[model samples]
Target chain A: MTESTNTPVIVLRGLKKHFGVGDAEQYALDGVDLTINKGEFVTIMGPSGSGKTTLLNVLGLLDTSIEGDYQLEGRAVNTLSKRQLARIRSRQIGFVFQSFNLINRLTVIENVALPLTYKGGLSHIKRLKKASEMLATFHLNEREYFLPYQLSGGQTQRVAIARALVNNPSIILADEPTGNLDSRASHIIMEELSDLHQRGNTIIMVTHNPDLTTYASRVITMLDGKIASDTDSLLGQPSVEFKRPLAMVVRPSTDNQAANSQTKPVVTTLSKVDRRKLKVAVRKRQQIAKNRAPARHAEEYHQ
Target chain B: MSRFLLSSHLQNARHSLRSNRSRTLLTILGIAIGVASITTIMSLGDGASQVVAQQISNLGGNLAIVRPGPSRTNFLTDITVPQGQNYATSTLTDSDVAAISALPHVKEIAPISVINSTITGQHSAPAGTPIVSTTPALSSVDGLQLDVGQFLDSNISQNTAVVGSNLARIIFGTTDALGQTAYIRGYNFTIIGVLKPLNQPINYNNIDFDNAIIIGQDIGRQLSNGSAQIQQINIRSDSAANLTSVVSSINKTLSAQHFGDKDFTVLANSDISQPTSELFYAVVGVTTSIAAISLFVGGIGIMNIMLVSVAERTREIGIRKAIGAHTTDIVWQFLIESLALSLSGGFLGYIAGYGLAFMISTALPFYPSFNWQIAAVSFGLSVLIGTIFGLYPAVRAARKDPIEALRYYS
Candidate 1:
């Protein structure tokens, strides 16, 4: 069970996930090969229905009915039982979703630390303490007892990310984690992810925003369930702008106030014509903020 | 999946039930009512049986009765024997009583004769009272305790009788009924004593002793065509330990007296109160089973609420699955939720059942005693029903695909 971090953490070769059978069969992930090494922040970009989610699901061990050779940490995962896969997923892979996916009935800390329940042998009190520390990392220590519904979109996403990393998973799989946040909140969340990346955590993110690739060490664009363009876009990375150290995000701050009451739906869920209008508005803002690199990055990443 | 974490699961289950207060309360009420009815019914059966057994034991530990046929008396059936061939027939005779009395380990015996004729003295009971005629030994053999006067002695005169406390008050209008005149079967007799209340009316033979008129055997035989049929003979052994041997010897003596016609029954060797107990068990069983239907309905309520809860929390299930929760985990969550509901209902039902039992014991003649078995059964039934009914819905919740659940709308 001891796996070194230097090994190729995930290797997906000829991964094909079909939705139906016979004439109705449609490939969700059609013959895609991708190998992600340790400490690599890989961002996946594609239009909707381009197999981005299916690929993420396959890698995360949430979907197994796919023909593929998925080797994780030098071990072949295809033959592993569901229980074993679940253990591996719990110990090594964490997931962050566009919807936050926090259980509405549980408090913020319970939602954050629920994945630890499957770990077994961990005292619940100690688990809560660990969850408290994880929440502190996102400057959310004060709101640990709040319910998911009581939280703002940004706070909910932070709680979700805290849950994902509570087990200390080496790889975090995020499916448009910032998709639900407002422009300001999205910047703060992305900044936290960037901090995590600097601390040598491997992250695989699926997003519709092509400009978010600037945060990734490698970017793979998909088309019709295939990797149409694989680019190692390291030069345009946001490393130069993140002058503050990663440890600073976890520092106790007295002024970290709650998010405002005003809330907006995740941009992707908006109607097509409204989304188009928003995108056009974002592009105009980007052009005006071209002189400012950080502002331009935020506009591109969100749009 | 690794560790059960029972406490945590219970806590979470309780939390979810609390979220829907009204539905949970209704479900609890359903199971509680069922439990209460079952407890009441069970108490009735237990109480009735205990009362009969205690009554039998009170007749003296070594005592046994030989009665005709399988006709044991219960309050639910006829309590006064009719005057006809059924009562006039000598299924047993005075010779049988003498023969049993002469057996090894045998003690003195008393044969009982019942006459459903009215006995009034200065006042009446408004209904015909039963008069029992037996020898002097009848008092000790049947464990009768007199309040004021001695029982019938060896007087050849048929002019003396004993009245029970209630009848004494109703007839002679006083507990000092000794030496008072009473009319029985158109014959005037002087009351020699007033009997204490027996506390119970039902006995082996169909006679309410508390309201009955007791007289010496010879006088009663003369009144009923110079000889009356002996309905039952009460036998008391020298030692309780030798009761079986005594009963066997009595049977042998009786069989020989009847030329080997074994038409009589010995109480210690047979189900003394079988028919009555069986009737009671049948009635209680049927009624309580109907009450159990309420528990079944309560379980269905839990399942209905759980199904709604699962559907409402589809996204929660998906999130949990994505975070490495096994199907077993999901199943346990829902199952525990359902269990919590039923068990709470059961607890409420237990309280309510005791309440109903109290009301019933007061309203009815049967004195109910506490029974742990009934509590155990009703509580266990609630939990069992919860598990059985909750399984399908819990399995359905577990079967949801993470992707599909994630996309589910409100």
Candidate 2:
């Protein structure tokens, strides 16, 4: 998990992001100071309203009107013009949003080629070729011509990932990538992310689920717009205890049929006892989802 | 702003606009209407000018006209018949005609005296039938062809007449009206000849000769109480080479004849078509400007629809910005979409406008002219309107905050 030179890819110092002014002011990100090294798969976990997405957005350079310094690869972000920052984002940063914000009108290949469109020199044919190649890595080559709505939840998320990596950005920022996926789909996404991390790409992912952090080399937890815990370990050890067993907790399922169809091949290889455990885990996650569904809606509204 | 990015943006703009095919087409239709009006006006105006020019060229280079108008009127004010006492005071006398005929290189002289009177034969003519009183030389000067019988005799005092084919039909109910008597103001005059049909109604004379009754100057003076209004004089030079010298000599002689009043306009060649063409242009210019106003309103329609489009595509804008599209790129995208709509409209309008012009030309004496200048102005106007009307909405899209924009789900 150790990067050879330990070169810092991102640096944030006393960064503050606030909404409104004076009496009505509220901080979305309050004085965050952190340094992420090259090739680190850092997972950020926090409850709702804890500023995880805000931090991710700021780190991705999607938000730059903050109080303090932000440096990406040793260049201060504040000094760059909006056009320059956008250029940097196009060339160096890849973003994955929770909703899998694939343009609904575009075909999957077109959606994946979007980032490369902002790139200056690459021809249209070359960009689509690169997108096709990226889709192949995600085993999504056959679905290139299909629209986003035509793809299953897992496939849509994979296409989103393909779009993110198509530009060969230096860092990937994912905000709740599996937030809408079922357990088996989440497992597949996590495996793909782990494969990317193994190949030495810097990835920062935000997630509500604690179990997903096991794939990360380091973990950070936020509370009330500030980081409450940061740890560099082989496996993430979140300070907050979850209601379910650590090994048994699963991603909340949004679509049961899609989840079942996707997990069928993997489920058949498991033993009878493990299959039963999987079913039990699924049931608990469903119950947790029902109880927490309204809160999730409220949180999205606040965001 | 590279070519690749621009092409991609154009492709995306096409895709997005195609998604709302009806709205795009409607917007394009608005622009097309504006362009169509302009093209139609321009084409028709040019056609009228071309017809007048064709008429003047047909008259031959040696011909010169002397008309009762201000010798030195402002060209701008004279475009629509300048308001003045020149018409009431200016007169062409017989001595003026005699003096012009004595000028060197003057081949012939024909003075036209218009006497307003109703003629009656087999049928009484319309109330305002023009009774033109001229000499026998008018046949050669005005290019009057004798369809069946002889022209007017040289005897100035003879009570003889000639009838245009149309007038003959209106009076005698036949084209061969030689030796037929026609009554004008209680005087019976024998129709000595029947003139050929002249299809051209719009000419320097502004008279449809096909509908005229021509009589000898002496009898016309008796009918009009010896004070006939001499409206114009047609002069033919000996040859095309001597036309300039003849015109100058006649101008000097006529000015001296009127005691240097110079209340006459001597016109030759293309100069003869100027007044008529200018009058045509003024009328067409007014109608064209009205059509231009409608085009401006169409541009406003484009602006209104573009604003609506920007609002609906807020989320799309957000997604693009979030994916690293710059503010200028967003502006270019929307601008290109509007340009596509407007340019397509322009192309459609150009074709439609010409169609309308040609259709209208069927009822007109001339056909509408088509040229590259009209096409260039039309397309240039469309591009300008698209850029201008598309700008505000594009800037509005570009000004959107990525965070707030992404929050827009629709």
Candidate 3:
């Protein structure tokens, strides 16, 4: 696992995923070879059953049964054990599903910070602080303690996004992020991801509506687990451009930096000014948790 | 599994139980009822024996009662009574008391003779007024209290009698009815003294002193067919420390008198109260086992509800696993919830059980005894039931595939 600056974050070659047996068999992902570099906002567009989600799941390292040379950051993912694959999934990949699957009984912060538990380094308080900062970025600071059942469709998706980004994963794989949301909510979510892309975070989104492809740096349409068409010149040229100065762009590391930045990852990416803001965010959240600790104690047995 | 993960599992379990309030309460109620039954039975058994033991201890601690019945000591052997036996075989006689009195360290001997006959008072005499005849040493041997009249004196051959307060009031129209003529079967007797009211009605004698017509052994023989059959012989040792020597001497004398048959028992302290105590333990054993069956059924009910919960929360399990929960974590969640339910039921049932025991004690003679050992047992049994029955559902929950669980709609 060499720390190479020019290495691609995701590399898939001759990927084939088969389902069922004999005559009844069909390929969910037949033969797909794809390469996604660092900070490339790749949008996968295809109709239903076009293997769009299967490709995203394979890239996310969630299901590893495919017969292919699937290398993530110069390391062969197939060679890695289940525990190591889970570690890669936790630190490198953040998934946002169409259903916005938040745990029923857990609160907003609990759902957001769940990925950090698998990564395992910071205390519960520190993890909560980091989750709170992510939620605050999406203007959901006050809704941190709310349950998933109490949230609307749009709010639930935003909380799910916050949960995905809390672990500071290099790539965000969204399988129909706005599939359940209204047009207005969908626009707000796309704008947040567009801003994240301009700040050099790689995003691979799967969508049914082609209107969402405008936010992608490279729009790749799939047909029968094969690339039907690809707008390849947009690899470094995303349609949605940021007005903010690119001078504050942080160098995104491709090595195993995800597992090491336990104490702070947001700090690792921020400039001096934004870094202090994150510190204050972490401190304020800790204070709020200290204040809410007594109330949480009362509700602990009741819940 | 870290401390935070364990705490999270417990918190999720509590939340799951709290979601469906009525089902949780009903299940808890079932467990509580089961727990209360066993606890009440055990407490009452302990309490009754405790009260009897305390009462026995209160009586100078130097007394031992010898009754004419089947020897409980020789339980394995088949003992029979003479033919045509009524109430109990009259195996004791007045000579037994006299012979026991001659033993060393023997202070006093009271021989009890029984005669059940109707009495006619000036106003009214109770239909079942029993006549108990004993020697003048009865007051010293038994803790008999007199209200305002004198007991029968052995020096006098006069047909005198002492009536219980209730019987005296009925037969003579007053407890102070001194020298009032009362008809016993066919003989008329003068009531010399009025006995005190004994609140304790049913004793080992199976006789209520409050409704008894007490007379001397001479009158008892006359009331019967000129033959007095002693029912029991009560001996009072000089001191509690002298009980062993006194009992051994009495046993030796009785053995010789019975021609080495040893059918009669010479008891001291707890030995005298064994028959009733053993009866209590038997009753408790039968009732506790029945209550245990109810608890087992209640445990099954918990398992049934937990299985339903696991099935219903399949989607929830998927969401948790997707967010990074291990398979063992799901199992821990449900097990904790079941434990919470039964343990809560146990706590509530313990309080209710003591309440039941206290209510029963007032209706009966003995008081309910309380001990921490039974409390621990009751609580521990409910917890054990919770864990033992909750296993199947928890394992089922943990074994579910994450992909399939997520695909489930409900």
Candidate 4:
């Protein structure tokens, strides 16, 4: 499916986070402005002390206290109470940490189902089914019964991603998700992320490896707790392409009157290949019309 | 989020306690020792008090003993009765006895005249055998029923003497010391009767009737240089219920007789009952304090270990807070853990205390009486101490900054 041209899912303006007071004060985040669009695969790049994790924490609503406005899906997060922030974090944003942060006592499936359990909108059986489905997608079906310690680093991270995806959050914030993985495992993880992005899921990952930027649609570089550069890929197009099928296929009917109302005459003769091509073009046009319907309705309401 | 916090708190508490089993056991032991000490002391105290009351009751519930003060003597010390200094004094003579008998609630007034005399029988017994000279009223007032033969009569003129059962058994090989002539201080006296055995030796005037040779009061006085003086007055109340009133009246009368100087000391069963009770209470108090100290120490140990646990699980605490654990939740977690440790220790200590008390009571002369109130009070104090001492640490744990705690590696 092709990505929808939706508004930015995350918006941060003049964000700042400082620690300590007076002369001892140090900036963990300094006047940062950033926007992450829906269905975009974005990667944040920075050094160890460059506030990459701190930015992720702020974006994930794990840390607050900044001199800025953070709007997640048009809701101002900075002014929200702790409970509201928690609700937003649980429902709208998912986080994947460097250390995999799996409760060691919980099994793999239980760890994956953590977010769903916290959100608590589904029955126990349904949650289990969803969790199993998600784990199967990650090829962790057999490992669902194993503890975190029993799984390899890659398996644990896959479990972590499954957990992040369980709540169907609007945005996934990953801080050094590949920091502890080897090259092979890192590629496997990046492939999973690429597939998620291809499916129109928004992901924001922070990494120090510059080569991993090819997987992202946008790359944001941070220096000294501030954004230094932001760039979008020119040629690394998304893998999935949306195309709807034509609804014009006709079948002969025995009842002439019924057929007359349900079917239309073929006015021109064409080859089978040409007919299929014309149908594809018509379906594409119809999909565009369908996509623009909501915008048109909103515009009419504004008038 | 609240569920996560609760589960995490419980998990961490269990983990910390399991990780340091030695410390937990030691703390429990300290508390147990404290409880055991207090319980044992209390049990012994109760036992001793009961023993005293039982012994006193056995002697005579309504018997009141009247003794002279520093200046005057009673019937046993009356020198004019011929018994000399061995007798109390003429200050408590026959007239005083007659006057005491006339008082209200007075059942019988018996004046005892005692002397130190040596007697030779089949074997020579120990010196200082009490040779008591008294009237027939002595038998009734002291509740000393004759074992064999009859008690001495005031009208008897034959220089006859009655021997205590123990004395008779020792000197004559049988309580049938009747018709046996015994030499007392070079005087020949026929043992015409045998007195009954009284389990407890008389302690009022340091007299032991087990070795005593009893005779008629007038004859005894006449034989001992005519200087007989009453050493003690044994007054029996008409009824057991009137003991207190009789003792008070007798005290007032004696006090008046001594020119309002209050020289004579009057003793009832209750007066002898106070010491054992006081000793018991004092022991209970002392033991309870000791137990309290142990509980305090155990509570402090719990706090110490809890503080360490908080420090160890700083990151866990931060994670819990980040997930939505309120300060109150954290406080409750730590407090619950402390209370659990102390309360369990209290229960174990109580069982141990009871066991120790039982063992000691069986091995020693004291009989232990368990008090549920003491256990309840101890348990309450343990919980209180746990809470009081655990508060600061729990609050400190709860108040830790989530950011800083999250950053803490260790």
Native A-B interface contacts kept, per candidate? 0.53, 0.70, 0.18, 0.05
Clash totals, every prediction: 2, 0, 4, 34
Superior by lDDT: candidate 2 or candidate 4: 2
Q: Which stretches of candidate 2 lie over 4 Å from their true place?
A: A1-5, A232-303, B61-122, B127-144, B148-163, B178-193, B213-290
lDDT of 4 by residue, B228-291 (tens): 6677788889888898898888777776766777656677775543222223344455566677
lDDT of each: 0.75, 0.79, 0.74, 0.69
Displacement of the residue B195 alpha carbon in candidate 3, Å: 4.2
Kindly give the stretch of ten consecutive residues in candidate 3 chain B with the minimal lDDT sum. Answer: B76-85
Task: Give the winner by TM-score: 2 or 4.
Answer: 2
Cα error, residue B221 of model 4, in Å, equals 23
Q: Model 4 chain A — which ten-residue stretch has the worst lDDT?
A: A242-251
Pull out the clashing pairs in model 2: none
* Tens digit per residue, CA lDDT, model 2, B205-247: 6566888888888888788688656778889998888999888
iRMSD for each candidate structure, in the order shown: 1.5, 1.0, 2.4, 4.4
How would you order the candidates by lDDT, starting with the best? 2, 1, 3, 4
TM-score on 0 to 1 scale for chain A of candidate 4: 0.75
Candidate 1 vs. true structure, TM-score = 0.75
What DockQ values do the models have?
A: 0.40, 0.52, 0.19, 0.08
Query: lDDT, candidate 3, residue B59?
Result: 79
Sorted on DockQ, highest at the top, how do the candidates line up?
2, 1, 3, 4
Q: Note each model's CA RMSD in angstroms.
A: 10.5, 10.4, 13.0, 17.9
